[model samples]
Target chain A: MNNEKVWTAGLVVIGDEILSGRTADKNIAQIASWLQVQGIRLAEVRVVADDMDAIAGAVNALRTAYDYLFTTGGIGPTHDDITVDAIAAALGVDVVIHPQARAMLEDYYKDKPGGLNDARLRMARVPDGADLIPNAMSGAPGIRHGNIFLMAGVPAITAQMLHGLTGQLEGGAPLMVETVGCWTAESEVAEILREVEKAHEGCQIGSYPFFREGRTGANFVIRSTSRDVLESAVDTLCEALAETGRDFTPGGI
Target chain B: MNNEKVWTAGLVVIGDEILSGRTADKNIAQIASWLQVQGIRLAEVRVVADDMDAIAGAVNALRTAYDYLFTTGGIGPTHDDITVDAIAAALGVDVVIHPQARAMLEDYYKDKPGGLNDARLRMARVPDGADLIPNAMSGAPGIRHGNIFLMAGVPAITAQMLHGLTGQLEGGAPLMVETVGCWTAESEVAEILREVEKAHEGCQIGSYPFFREGRTGANFVIRSTSRDVLESAVDTLCEALAETGRDFTPGGI
Candidate 1:
């Protein structure tokens, strides 16, 4: 992953189903992975209900705080789906149907068996001035304005829209990661752990405690932009773990 | 579950492991379930890295915005576990060794070797004026300061602490949920759907379209605090779906 660019992204998962735990959101992970490949880091993720005030507050806060903000859900062709109006309210703009969006829908359903009607036409309503994001899975396109990208909430469609959208973004350098797995408690490796952190000042070293089948251990992942820096930090970590007579194995990039 | 209490809760899931996709945090789901059982709605959830600034910002924001805030992670003995200090910083107070917390640890390790040392005692440090929430699984108790409850990130230990802490909270009236599952497209059910919504003024309804096992349909979940209102809404929804020759099953409490 590239880490050279200074791009940071945040996710606003808009849906009451998600907050109620009735639906498990997959868009956050999908977007985070796409951003990683594009060298953008996903710094924060927030889940809010479909309430207008909550949606507006999250959209405004995240759009201004991060370099890119991606929202999924509430952009469907039903009355309960109010993402467009809520987003317009967040931007303090009047919601209006865009002509280009309507034309796109007209062209999309011109040959389809299920003809487009007023209900289907609801998908064409977009906040004023937002650019359309082509949805490869389905015809109804996503909309983007400023730093916020509004996409469908369905996992497959969201992934397709994100795949097409990433190409349009300028990515930072991908982050490099190296890990050493060992069956030692984190506290046992504390002394040399501090030294490793101090030596790799440019990298982030994290110790994650894990337990499986009654066994307890940790996986230490060292991350940095520079390969040499990450490798050197892993070497130090391995040596430290070795001194404790602990079993350690190197993991992939 | 009572909704009359009018209290809201938020969750803060700490740890870079989750943001990097190395681990899927379970604390949010656990806390959400616990809060739901108590009739306290979980208003929002934030997943952030282990950085002090991120943790502090989330803690401060959630504590102020919601009636209660619960945080999970960064409470281990390792150097990377800095949640105690971060919570203290969020409260703009100094971290102090609470006598009750120290006593709990003392009792926990009284007969064990390598008992509470200076390093291990670090777990006993908490924000000033905070009360301890006993951990049934492990002796390292969680700390509660007014509305904010700080607990361990481990699933088992977090569950234990939350169970001990729930009884102290004032619960809102239980949220009532009703669902109608039907094999109808969103566009096909648009007109009567709006009528059902307009007729039910107090409840909120959500339409979720899903394509599972080669079938296409949607599920509408109607939620409210009053059972009578929810039942009437569900009845109206059923009648509307009946007009379209669609079937629905009642779901949820």
Candidate 2:
């Protein structure tokens, strides 16, 4: 087993649209995938309402628990956009307009119909002593106050912020995963799955059962920091499934 | 504004697939929408890993904070499926087999191959003093202990569990929402939204920006428990947008 220190991150998805089911959230998956590429595990995620206290509570709880904390949503140019204020409160810092963010927004919106007005300038506000994360899709940038990153609620804008943060944070070895899919009920082979996982050191197997095409099947996902350990676990699981006279797919269903 | 005590729920999504970005979670929206229909607000959500400590910690935190707590995932037959154990630990109870659940599972697997093995029997286990929430999609029922409900990770199964739970929970009045979509950027209408919300006694407006068809657009979701307040807020918002000379869609984009 690798003895390297593992880095973890927590995500706070700030939006009433998500909690109210008015909008489906895509940022959690997007950010989780991006963090995986950065070799940091997404340890936890909280979907909070647009309320100031809710956002601030999640920010405070997660920021101290993980190595880094990223928040998406409620950062737009409207009254509902209170993430900047909430995060600032959580960190006990005053909100301030970043000079660079204001400059960028001014240049971008200058040619538009309505120039950078008071409402539009709200995008430039950030927690005190924060750096700006460049937004490729929109001129208003993302905010970074210490280990906490405040991103836009829109998935496209959050993607740009994540891109700007690539290769910037320190992390351990990226987790490796291999999945084996079977056309049988996982409960029928639950013992086999348990034995294989027990035999493989440093590897954890997760069985996800599904009902599709009028049949029961499951995908066994094996994850590990060591590629060799992950591969071995998959091989053992596949061989065990084969011994039970069941067909298995290597890349999953 | 109504002085009725509002009912709130906290959802704990327990799975490694969600945290790994291997599976996009549909339960948060599903449960959120369902809770709304039940006149209960989904106040918070936590996507936690399959670890026992993680699940137990979230369970304890949320179960006490809200009127009710619901959890999805990690209740399968596999070793990694430790949600039952974790939840039991959180409630300070012993794990035991529910006779009704065992009978249900036995009947469920009787006609299939490998009928009712030890692993399949694992589905019958629940925390002491728990009742079963019927799973219409699958035979293994969901467990309900006090205000905490443990459901399946699969959307279909979770739907069945939620259906069984409909009209059973005590809640306040259902929140009503009216959306207004506009082709203009939401930033241009920020003040208008704030003004509309402030004018309506019980209404709250949320701005969701979207970039589509090579143009900027936004959907303003107005929510209120009172029908009069919601309709009035929407009318004022529409009139405000019209005054700005921008076209708006009442039902949203």
In candidate 2 the C-alpha lDDT for residue B52 amounts to 86
- lDDT of candidate 1 over B1-253, digit per residue (tens): 2335567988888887777766666777677777877888889988888899999999999999999998889887777789989989989889999898789878977775557766568778998888888886657889888899888888889989988976678877767777888876676676667778788766778888877777767888888888888888899888877876767666621
Model 1 C-alpha lDDT per residue in residues A47-157, reported as the tens digit of each score: 888888988988898889889998999888888778889999988887777787788878877875456777778888777778888886667888898888998989898
Fnat for each predicted structure, in order: 0.42, 0.78
Model 2 stretches astray by more than 4 angstroms? none
How far is B65's C-alpha from truth in model 2 (Å)? 0.8
- Cα error, candidate 2, residue A31 (Å): 0.9
Per-residue alpha-carbon lDDT of model 2 for B7-59, expressed as tens digits? Answer: 99999999989998988899999999999999999999999998889999999
What is model 2's C-alpha RMSD?
0.9
**DockQ scores for all predicted structures:** 0.50, 0.86
- Candidate 2: residue B193 Cα off by (Å): 0.4
Model 2 CAPRI quality: high
Candidate 1 positional error at A229, Å:
0.7
